[model samples]
Target chain A: MSTILECKNLSKAYGGKTALSHVSLSLNGGHIIGLLGPNGSGKTTLIKLINGLLTPSEGSLLVGGHPVGVESKRITSYLPDQSYLNANLKIKEIISYFDDFYNDFDKARAYDMLEKLSIHPEAKLKTMSKGTKEKVQLILVMSRRAKLYILDEPIAGVDPAARDYILNTILSNYEEDATILISTHLISDIENILDEVIFIKDGQIVLNSSVDKIREENGKSVDSLFREVFKC
Target chain B: MAWNLNSDRPIFMQLIEIIQISIISGKYAPGSKLPSVRDLASEAAVNPNTMQKALAELERSGLVFSQRTSGRFITEDVAMIEDLKSTLAKEKMKQFLESMRQLGFQKEETLALMSKFLKGDHS
Candidate 1:
């Protein structure tokens, strides 16, 4: 399979603190990969580098064989951990904005998903509850037919039911040819669907392997192995 | 019918065994429909994706057949179910015997424990 994203010796630092340090990883098409790490482990930083939200302090990131830039952005759909939308905009307006920005954005599918979630398109972002807004954002990101979907902490801070809905939405949406990279610390919940896992710690990759191989070799659940490796 | 299973072995393999057991025990007769994916997932409290994977494995093994709109059903071949049950039982028995030997339990003592456990007497 072709490599969807490749990071070579990527590093990002803010003032004297390092967020990511010489981290090298690659994602291939048609894979749902878990980007797992504890808080302050640079999971968000790595995702930012891939999405070109932040220029790497050193090294490089390539998406779909092109360097991270305008061209790469076109093929990548990013869902940041925080809400990036303007609170004043209505849900329908948000969908229109995505439609204008992305060529592959599927407005019909977005509306379908909203209908499933019972989200009112006329409701403004400022009016919806935080969890509802998160669901809306997730629906929009997942509705895009982009080559790579970079989801940062997709299920974080949500109730268990909402988490299940978000995860199921991800599993049901997205083209078979596309790749999904989900960055989160909830390893156990998402462990089954992941084809591969990239474990990041202290701004570096400590383990990256297929889920089946990890289970076969370690004879333990990925969550258990994670605890053993990154235990405090 | 849904199978209740808890084993240290891999879940997918255990699922296969459970399906075979259901067949051998006549819980799922030939031509009978199996539980839907969603139902099975909720019953097991496992990810639907994991349940789908196990079902796909069963379909590939020719032990189950799926109709796109109608859902999956058990195969009509009883011999296949019998073969699966015998193979799995032998494997599990071998492992149990090996563990007993390693624990230094002689055959007579092992039979005695089995009898007491089966008879519900703990004296």
Candidate 2:
């Protein structure tokens, strides 16, 4: 497998405070990895750096062997923690916008997912419930056939049923060459789907290993281990 | 059968057990084509790589086999399936006896209780 993401001594700072320090990581393609940490543990900082929203204050980062730039942006799809969609636009209009923006966007696949949820293309985003809006946003983000999918807390704030839908959508979508990096503290909910996990704490990587290896070697689940490692 | 995996053990091992039980129980009939790895992974809500590892173990154990063009299939060896079924049953029986022993029941008493329960003697 190819190295889809690589970070060398990556660090980020906000004025006087350090968010991430010397965080070196390498992610391979064709796996679902969990970027797990508590709130303010630099999960978002790492994601932003990879998405080119923020430049790393120190060290170098690369996606698909190239530095984070237009080339990387073309192949990376990011779903931030907050809602970035316009509430005034209808679902169909959003689909059109995504299609116009992303060359790899599959409009038909997006519509199919919407129809499965009974979400009408004419329905305005503001008229839908939060859960439905999240679903729509997820569908739009996943519609792109990008190489790397960086999802920041995709399952947080959603109900169990909707969480299952989101996970299933992630599983069914994406090609064999793509990699998905899901950032969340909800480990147990998504542990079953992850091949590997990176535990971040206070902006530093505390653990990075395959989920099965962790369970086999420690005889404990990743969720339990996370609690033990980051316990207050 | 559903994939009821726990977080305590390696998921691939649990998958092996589940598939083995399914095979011995005739849920996946002998010589039947197993679903694609992708389908199995999605249904089980697991990483395809993990599912692939489990399937590879099953294949190595002679319970399952794959054809380059057709896909994976259960072994047609009825005798081998029967042997596996009895092995699994014996393992379960051993665990039941062990638990009964822990509950302070002697082997003979446990056997008697088991027979009585088998006869529908609820009282």
Candidate 3:
């Protein structure tokens, strides 16, 4: 498989405090990787760097072997930690917006997902619940034929049923060769679906290994191992 | 149909056992085509790559075979299926015997208890 994302000696700092320090990692195509860390652990910083939202203070960051730029952004679909849609627009209008913005966006797939969720096309964004909005954003992002997908806390603060729906949607969508990078503190819910996990602690890459290897070697689930590693 | 996998073991291994049992129990009859990897992965709520790995392992063991155009199919060899069933049954029997021995039950007493239970004696 080709390398989809790589960072060499990547570091980020805000004034006197450091968010990520000398972190280096590479991701391959056709994987569902978990970027797991506690809050304030540089998970968001790494994600932002990949999405080209913030420039690195030192070292290099590359997406699809290209430095973070228009080319990289064009092939990378990102679901931000916060909802960023216009509240006044209807669901259909937002779909059109994405259709116009991204050449790879699939309008039919987006609408099909919306209909599956029982979300009417005429429903306005402001009226939908928070969980519903997250689903919409995820559906839009996954509908793209991007090579790399960066999902920032996709299941946070949602009910368990809604989380299952979101996870199923993620699994059913996406091409086989594309890669997905999901950052979350809730490890157990998504552990089964993860191919590998990169545990980030205080902005440093602590552990990177396949989920199956972790379970086989450590004789414990990723959730248990994470609890033992990041215990306070 | 539930893939009730435990967290302590590797998932692909569990998937292999699950599919093996499905075959032996006639849930998935011999010579039947298996579902696509994507469908199986979604049904089990696991990564498709992991499912593929499990299917590959099964193919290696001759429990399943794949054709170029058609997907995957369970083997039609009944003797091989019977061999797998006996192996699993022996493993379970060994475990049961070990547990009974741990409880300090002798061979004669264990046989007596099993005979009584098989005779539908509740007391």
Candidate 4:
């Protein structure tokens, strides 16, 4: 298996607060890796670093064997935990923007997904509900045929039915050779789909392993082990 | 086909078992086309990755074969499914016999329980 992403001693800080500290990890192609941590545990920071939205204060990140930069951004599709689209834009306008910017973006798939969600292309982002907006954002990000997908809290704050929909969309849209790194604290819901998991706490990696190896070695499900390791 | 899932087991493993049972029962007949991974995932309300893993496992066991663009299909080899069924059946019977023996049941009592259960007019 070829390495799709590699991070070496990555560190990030905001003023006096440390969001990540010397984190090192590598992901292979075709992996659905779960990035797990509690609140303030640096999950978002790590994702941002990988997405090149924020440069690491120290260390290096290589996406598809290239350093994090404009080139890396082209091959990386990101879905932030919160909506980042302008509220004034219509759903169709946002799709056009993605189509123009991302060479790999599939406009037909995005439209198909929107239709499935019953979202009208003429609907304004400002007028839609929070959950609806989130769904739209997800549809846009997932329609891109990027080599790496960095999804932060994809299912957070959604109802159970919508959560299932979001997860299903992710599964259906991702390319076979791509690597999807989903950051979430919702372990139980995603524990089954994950091929590998990297647990972060206090700005540091605490556990990282393939799901099969973890289950075989620990004799416990990933959810149970997460509860044990991150017990409060 | 519906799966008899155990909460204790992982969903993907249960999915593999369900597909195997389908093969055994001829619901997914030999050489017949199996459902797309996306369709199966949607039907089961599971992540596509989970379904993909199950399909991959099936492929490894020679119980299913994929044709790239055409999608996955049940393997034409009936022996593979029969082998899996026999292995699983033997393991299950072993556990049942062990439990009965631990409960102080002799061979005669075990036979009696089987006969009594089989004779019932189950609706």
Q: What interface RMSD do all candidates show, one decimal each? A: 4.2, 0.7, 0.4, 3.1
Report the C-alpha lDDT of model 1 over A98-177, residue by residue, as the tens digit.
99989999999999999999999999999988889889999999989999999998888789888877877887787777
Docking tier of model 1: it is incorrect
Once fitted onto the true fold, the runs of candidate 2 whose alpha carbons sit more than 4 angstroms away are none
Query: Of 2 and 3, which scores higher on TM-score?
Result: 3
TM-score of chain B of each: 0.74, 0.95, 0.96, 0.82
Query: Highest TM-score, which number?
Result: 3
- Candidate 2 residue B79 Cα shift, in angstroms, is 1.6
Native A-B contact fraction in model 1: 0.05
- lDDT tens string, model 3, B31-89? 99999999999999899999999999999999999988999999999999999999999
Span of ten consecutive residues with least summed lDDT in model 2 chain B: B1-10
**What TM value does the first chain of each candidate achieve?**
0.97, 0.99, 0.99, 0.96
Clash pairs, candidate 1, are: none
At residue A50, give the lDDT of candidate 1. Answer: 90
Each candidate structure's count of clashing pairs: 0, 0, 0, 0
Please give the TM-score that candidate 3 achieves against the real structure: 0.98
Candidate 3: Cα lDDT at B121: 100
List ranges where model 4 is wrong by over 4 Å.
B1-13, B36-62, B65-73, B77-80, B101-107, B121-123
- Name the lDDT value of residue A14 in candidate 1: 95
Tens-digit lDDT track for model 2 on B1-123? 226899989989998998898898888999999999989988888888889999999999899999999999999999999999999999999999999999999999999998999999979
Instruction: Judge candidate 3 at residue B95 and give its lDDT.
Output: 95
Model 4 clashing residue pairs (backbone): none
Instruction: List the DockQ of the predictions in order.
Output: 0.21, 0.85, 0.91, 0.35
The Cα error of candidate 2 at residue A121, in Å, is 0.7
Which candidate would rank higher by TM-score, 3 or 4?
3
**Candidate 1: tens digits of C-alpha lDDT, residues B7-123:** 223556666666677787898898899998756655554445457778999899998999989999999998888888898889997898889989999888888887998999877
lDDT by residue (tens digit), candidate 4, B16-110: 88888888888899999998887887666555767888899989878899998999999888788789889889989889989999999987899
